[model samples]
Target: NECASPQKYHVDCDSNAVCVDTEEGYSCRCRPGFADISEAFNRLPGRKCVEAVNECLDTRLNQCSENAICEDAKEGYICTCRQGFVDASPNITHYPGRICNKPRKPDDDHQVSHQLDSCNPKDPRCGNNAICTDRKNKGQFICECAEKAFRFDDGSCRLSAACDVSNDCDKNAVCANVFDSYKCQCRPGYIDLSPDPETRPGRYCKELVNECATNAHDCSPFAECIDATDGYACVCTDGFSDTSSTAGLLPGRKCSNSSNECLDRSTHTCDDNADCIDTPDGYNCQCISGYVDVSSSANLPPGRVCTVQTTCPKQKTDLMFLIDGSGSIGSYVFKHEVLRFIKEFVELFDIGLDRTRVGLIQYSDQIRHEFDLNQYSDKSSLLHAIESTHYLTG
Candidate 1:
């Protein structure tokens, strides 16, 4: 009856103990490994069996995790973790259920190891032309292009020059970089004729034509058509020239009347005491002022040679004089003094085409033509006619 109902008495025993019913009274005894600190049987009058010492309650005796739960046992204790907790130590054999740690998820950032062992040195495992790097998080890394290289449009890595604008091309032509080279193209008004795909890709601006060939030119009438690279020129003809040379090379060149280029001595055959005259064909030479040549039998050579008229032979000479007769000097002074002066001057020359010839004229407001040298053959007739000449007043 005691084993069946130990609480039926005035006292009760702990569940860890067994109750025995003697002939005299009921007694309480602890089960195996259990100890009773309270002497419940020694209680006065009636035995009080409610004292049991729990060994699991002592931290030294209970081996439980900091996050685990400790249960009381009869003689010892058992340590175990909560429903979702686990051991924190890497090796859990020695400290199973002693410390509780949350399970690490591969996707969780906090679960990642902060040590430098994340990257495997032996196996970088990166793509071609790429480098691997392990930054803040261990066991994780990123891939990047190698040195002096970049990513291409085809998601490929290559070694080549980088570009952001067309100016980076050769000769400032229109071009862009490819995988390991560049592609070239011609600009407006320029086209490629002979393309060599073996040496260079795409067309180059090498074979250029005159744009004016297809377009109208504003060249002047005096200009001629000249074909040039990438354009046409409107150049002045032989008798004409432009002050601006670029006008011909470019556009808007207008040919104008060319000035006499005789000033350039090297370009002309004119000699000293001569004048160079530019002509449509070439150039011509003429004697200068106050110069005459009596040689060559009255037929002047087409060149520059001059001598004083006084030094010429008498045959080439034809002389004339006009004496001022305005009311300043009286007719008496005119005939005597002036006539004497003339008489003396005429005696010094041989009067003929083969020698020398002479004529005379007197003028005030009106002119008097006495006689031409051709009218007389000898000096005696000329002197006789001069004496018979008449005088007039203003």
Candidate 2:
């Protein structure tokens, strides 16, 4: 009845799934997925299955953006919308799901920044009387003369000179033109200076009068000089040197001849043919090329010269003498002087007597003609007549 042992246990249960059991022995077993209910069996570890969800019906998914359907999937959900729908703040509003929207790319700096092509700092706004220059996209430059006006070569602006008005520079300064600017220099004759060229004008003419430093001869027996505001003036000295020579002289007042200096001191060339006798002030000569002295004596006294000397020498000696006989001489004294003058005059020209003749005239404030050479015989008779004349008293 109980025939099971390690050696012969199998003959008892081959059909019903029993086995012989020993240290090495399990005999018969059921196939996998088929359980042996009443028998003790070894079990394998199992996994918890991941069940599929329908996100469309699950409000917790919130998968759709706005105004769309949540398309459910086995794993998760997606948003689906018909065409032509938009939802603005679907995330905050939590309203209906959002529709399909275009994706956005990051913006470039050019799209966000503000720029000026010509006149930014490169082309900044200009000050008064200024001009703006542009180099490139962002390049801006300024050039001009300002209200006061100065100039620069490269980056700096410049001022120019017109000098129309004296105010272009200081009163004493001369405004000169430079490449891009104007510079100021002092007046030629004046010196001493101010700190600024613009503000301090004629104020810089601080040089004191160098009265004697130059040709400033301050005085003379003829005249004395005094300085005036702008320059100097002359005062007649008590002892007069008859500055009649300086009649209309200015600046260089001197005892020049009363006769016109222009008469002698002329640069005009003598184009006309003439013998020009040059004087200190000017010159006078006959136009010898065509003109001649025609005055000649028809009949003359014995020893008086009436020679015919021609071929005009450069100079024709003309003497004009002024004598003072204002009651200062005695009656006979006048006669003696006249006789002495005639004798001396004859002797002084003894060598040239043939070419020269002496004439006698008397003047005592009222010139009186005594005798002319056309009538007198010789210097002796001429002297006799001069001695007979009395001094006229005024």
Report, for every candidate in turn, its global Cα lDDT versus the true structure: 0.54, 0.41
Off by over 4 Å in 2: 1-125, 135-212, 216-219, 236-394
Report clashes for each candidate as comma-separated counts. Answer: 5, 21
Best by TM-score: 1
Q: Give the worst 10-residue stretch by lDDT in candidate 1.
A: 38-47
Judge candidate 1 at residue 11 and give its lDDT: 45
Among these predictions, the greatest lDDT belongs to 1
lDDT of 2 by residue, 1-394 (tens): 1225524543333233444354653434433332332211111111111334466786676656554557653334545342323233233111223433322222433342323223344545754335555434354453433443443323343333333322344565444332233334444344535566354343355544435223355444355555443445666554333444445555335543444433443543332444455555444444453343221121222212222334432233222223445576766665555445544444333222344444555566688655554555454565455556556655
What are the candidates' C-alpha RMSDs?
49.0, 55.6
Write candidate 1's Cα lDDT for 252-297 as tens digits: 2655456565868877756567788885435678767766532222
Query: What's the alpha carbon RMSD for model 1?
Result: 49.0
In model 1, which runs have C-alpha deviations exceeding 4 angstroms? 1-129, 135-143, 146-162, 165-168, 176-182, 191-318, 323-394
